[model samples]
Target: MPEPYALLIEGGTIVDGSGERGFAAAVGVRDGRIELVYGPTDQIRAERRVDATERVVTPGFIDLHSHSGLMIFADPLHEPKVRQGVTTEVIGVDGLSYAPIPDPTDLEALAHINAGLDGRPDIAYDWSSVESYLDRLDGLRPSLNLAFMVGNSALRIGAMGWDEVVASADDLANMRAMLREAMEEGAIGVSSGLDYPPGAYASTEELAALTAEAARGGGFYHTHVRYDLGDRYLDPFREAIEIGRLGEGPAHITHFYHRQTFPDGPGPMLALVDDARADGQDVTFDTYPYEWASTRLLIMIPPWAQSGGPVQTKERLADAGVRDRIRREMAERGVLFAGRRAWDDVRIGAFTVPELIPWEGRTLGDVIADRGDDPVDVLCDLLLAEDLRVNQVTPGPWTETLRDFIRHPIGMIGTDSTFVGAKPSPRTYGSFPRVLGQFVREEALLSLEEAVRSMTSAPAARIGLDDRGLVRDGFVADLVVLDPERVRSNATYDEPRSYPDGIDRVVVGGTIVVEDGAHTGARPGRVLRRGG
Candidate 1:
């Protein structure tokens, strides 16, 4: 007689993550994959069973944007994401990753620059190659799967030093070779954050070259667009699509949102993608369903000010003349700059100093007022005082405009979750539930099946993962159980760390890692390499 199945889930409405309607079924799991989706009356026995009678069974969520490259090593349980039903996440986003930097000096400098966005974990900075970094995650027992991308910044720092210099032919060739090697070693694609140097220093031609290499390796280009380029509205997206066209590859825009500051409406912004897809360019986008956005405080400064890496950046922050120039340039360029309104609308956190604790969760405008100093002085002072490790939460999109992106056909979900400081973005804790509860259940923007499809199979297809994104037979068992009526996010802007409700259980690789909305300390997650 054959042995009993490893686990059996019974009496649940299976929402198969393929945008299919709900149906009553019994799921059988054996050897870490779904063995059968059987009828309710079928006789089955297993090592354990979950009575999901009143719950919805679906594929575990996949986050297309995550900043857990370092924090996951420090806290392998990864409660905030796993508790929200995220079983796999794409790291090395925004053109900022920790690996593929052969230079230790550059690695340490990058760490200082990214401390506010991704935390400064106490772990050793040992690995330099892409394969070694993924191996490091495997050794530490990551709580959820991570897919790595070759950040253009790492490539730039490797080819040329961490300066804002135009790439020569030799430099471009070196970068393409580096990107090719990274993809060969398991990197899924190349990513760029055009606002962040030295990757930001890379021009359209340079990115197109790297994208061509990635395309040869069956990869795409995932970018945080050059928001300051062209008109600062549609032009950024236009550049992304043009890169895809020039490189002859797929382009995926991350954190696609409509801000109140954009002069045009969301319609024009979305139309770029529609037109691109219409022309067979293979463009897609991901947006979190929140009105607020968060990132490092260093983002408020210009890229030229951040040139020459962290040491030079610190020197510039301390220079009086540089401060005046920054003020003037910020006024002149309007680089995510809104003057006093920007300062007033901004809330900051992630202070490690006792003296700065009072400023956490407070507006930058309020701090400037209290200190009776210019906003530039206050900004420079805070950055210098904290060693350039402050983060900001600011008003980004209006809720109505955000809903338009959510309902778009080419749009998927990427929480853009930043994990640092006392007040992280509520999207970190609430993105999936907010969509499931508020968007799908409350507002009827789309059905539950469509929402799950965006979070699961859509991202899986984008990532080229064939085995883990569905509930079909022979697929890996990464599943989520939810109470449809009770599922909602308890997290908000003022209270950001709260866990969600109605997520009953989560499974990763056929093992229950989250039960009753809490981490069960199971380390079943592995590094999911491309085509592995």
Candidate 2:
């Protein structure tokens, strides 16, 4: 009578992503939505069938924080993510992206600062509004769905230049208008990188005013706190919480973790979050499962010396007096990799200069030792030569600290992975699988059902996606099938590009993108917009 279902996945242990226990069931798909989820005893007919016997069937993962916004345009296949069972990624993180630019110069300036994290792809910089940029993505036909946030840095640059001055009344008004426009163009929220320039110069009142506009549109505020693990460590967290209160919006902290230098560990840091929540403020956070953290190497420069764009910053780095001031400030404040770990713990993750390819994977301390020069001079020279386009990975975190945060009720997962260069962090390819294999199966840190919920339902709820992130009737058919016993991340810091093991198949919108542990070249992904 009725037409046969388009596809069927039968005889699998269905972990429905609601923190419930797994059950044996069969799932049917038709018109890109889940048609039925029946028990194994029920008979179902389909045009095609996948015998998912002895496997764990769950919803595909959602990456809450990612830097693949521009990189995806360069390489639309995005094998690194699709192979790891990721179906959606939230981009425009750390408040730096290429949308809402006022002019071509603003886009170029932002691209230069962002080149270390997102490589300078050969694609055209054709769009200036959030809607136009999202339309460009829709035409690219990527492998995973993409959702975006309006970047605060882009907002600041659009309203003002890269000067270190605070915002005036007119400046604040212009920024608010820009934020409202982006939200109307389908952005989920606004994000900020307070430690980086342009955004670093913004005052608390300025941030509150702009975030209030996002709140008025039913969007949240995501921020990478100003500082982590130092004498002034707690101040930044307090500032972020205060912003959410002042702006009257939900706040989500990106990459919330304790550094090894913290004397009391994550207990004190997480206590701050508890206090905020107890006071009736909406706050949540995400973290990756790794001991080393990665970011642009230019962040180590003193804020005073980084006023202008990359060109001016490079000019200052060439001055001896400025270099001395930077070194003194770093020493006095215990900045960079000083307090937490030695220079040997800091490795070069990526560089823009072709000659520096050999330096990839080498420690900064090792480079200084081989060059026979002062550490400060060596660092300044490298940045100047590379035009501030460099990335670094510093080792950090304690075992107890990681366990405490991951088990917290409001905690979710985010890779914070910058997918660029030859030696990117292994988390880019291994984050979700590592949590499943090491944390869930090997160490028993969390149950398989709870882990699935964190990767699926929790992130979906955070971004307000109603039709995805769960294995339910009428939901989008984005799912993963894996062998729980054999699932594990094979990527290492040395060889960071390798994919994980035990992912049998990955489906997006009822089409198989990865089958038999290999990519099938299906590009069914679309750009997701807020309230669309």
Candidate 3:
């Protein structure tokens, strides 16, 4: 019925993403699948063959938590991802996404909320429903495969207005309906941004109900938990545990970490995970390797103060009395910005505007000195101007903090970096390279085998990717080959958009998309769906 196809990736040492030691193997592909691997067969003879001697062949990297949502489609070349050997990215992260909006105003509000995925066109706004949004992805021939989580914020906007109060019975019903519809339309799961609006207004019961729907549809519940740094913030972790227990869906903790301010680091958090796992709840998580975290300037605003809508937030900034009150609350709570944290570790990352770009690689303290303004007022004004979509980075401890997660059985790696075409965070370009080069090859933090597994099979397994994240027969032919000794991420915070080095070749569905460290401009990737 269809034409026969074959290709051979010969002589590479395949890592296989199975946590097993690599061995020299020739992988064969046909009909967009691995026809044969590590065996002699007539199928190996093909019209195309790649000599990959001395190269590391592994399943293409999977980004478990990504913000590439619409950006990947907007810029199908998506060098920020492809150069890092990523073949599949799980987007719609941090409890924010573009689907299931209730109205045009709601959609506009969403676009303003996360400017990291900027330059999206209004014509791209044609899809209003979750199914239609996913279908839009189908028409775009992106460089990598994509999967999305139906955001908790999208559901809230569909159910209730962006108000600070609890939902009415009708509101709850409508929200649940949207969640159900999204899941049915092939969403892999539900992601909640507990720290952000609309979702911030949702109660634990609401979360439980939504997650239960995900479970019914055989999906996971991923969350950017409400808080991560202070005493009161630990309550959100507890809330997440409760959601896992109540929802009966696998709970995936997005951007898992612990602030240095805590006497205990990931120790207590890991213990909680153990306790939950022992109770038979499906609990897993992801973390980026860097010691710095990125988010909007609005994080300094007390959650209660931001409970009102953005209009009220802007008004509060204009009133001296209100501004002083907010400032006092931040001081009392030990909230810090621009590297002058009550705690010592916070740094600054890139900004939405070019003028702030000079501060991209510096500490928050340096940014404050450069601006010669109170960090508080600068932050407030930035939030107001950008509609709270400006980005900032906070410092973190790398050694133990990252090692603990990589060592954990259930933990995987994610960049947590938002994608905006070529104008992306360094993590988009450097995350996997840093893991392979700095962590595995240089510091010996992890064996090359372990590092590959964490980046590949572990995340693929977490998201239930079938016949993938492995170099086995009948599997998807998404693969990457690298010169192990030469691999490294060249993209630094100052030069955030640079591509990595030593990616020998990349194949998507058996088509060579990247050849010898350069993109081939191929569009062989697909829109992966749940249970498809």
> What TM-score, over all chains together, does every model reach?
0.98, 0.96, 0.91
For each of the candidates, the C-alpha root-mean-square deviation to the true structure, in angstroms, is: 1.2, 1.8, 3.1
Arrange candidates by TM-score, descending.
Answer: 1, 2, 3
Model 2: runs farther than 4 Å from truth? 40-43, 228-230, 335-341, 352-354
Candidate 1 residue lDDT tens string, 1-532: 6577788889899999999898888778899999755676346768898889999999999999999998899988888999899999999999998889999888999989988888888889999999999999989887788898889999999999888899999999999988988998899999999998899999998999988999999899999999989888999999999999999999999999998768879999899999999998899999998777899999988899999999999999999999999988888876435667777888998999889989999999989989999889999999989999999998876876999998887789898998898888899999999999999999999999999999999999999899988999999999999999989998899998999999999999999999987889998998888878
Q: Tens-digit lDDT track for model 2 on 399-436?
A: 56787777787888888877776777888888889889
Better of 1 and 2 by lDDT: 1
For residues 153-259, write the lDDT of model 3, one tens digit per residue: 88887777677888888887787788888878888889998877778777888888888988888788998887742464366677888897888888988778766
lDDT (0-100) at residue 168 of candidate 1? Answer: 98
**What's the residue-level lDDT of 385 in candidate 1?**
93
* Error in Å for residue 532 of model 1: 0.8
Top candidate, metric TM-score: 1
Residue-level lDDT for 99 in candidate 3: 91
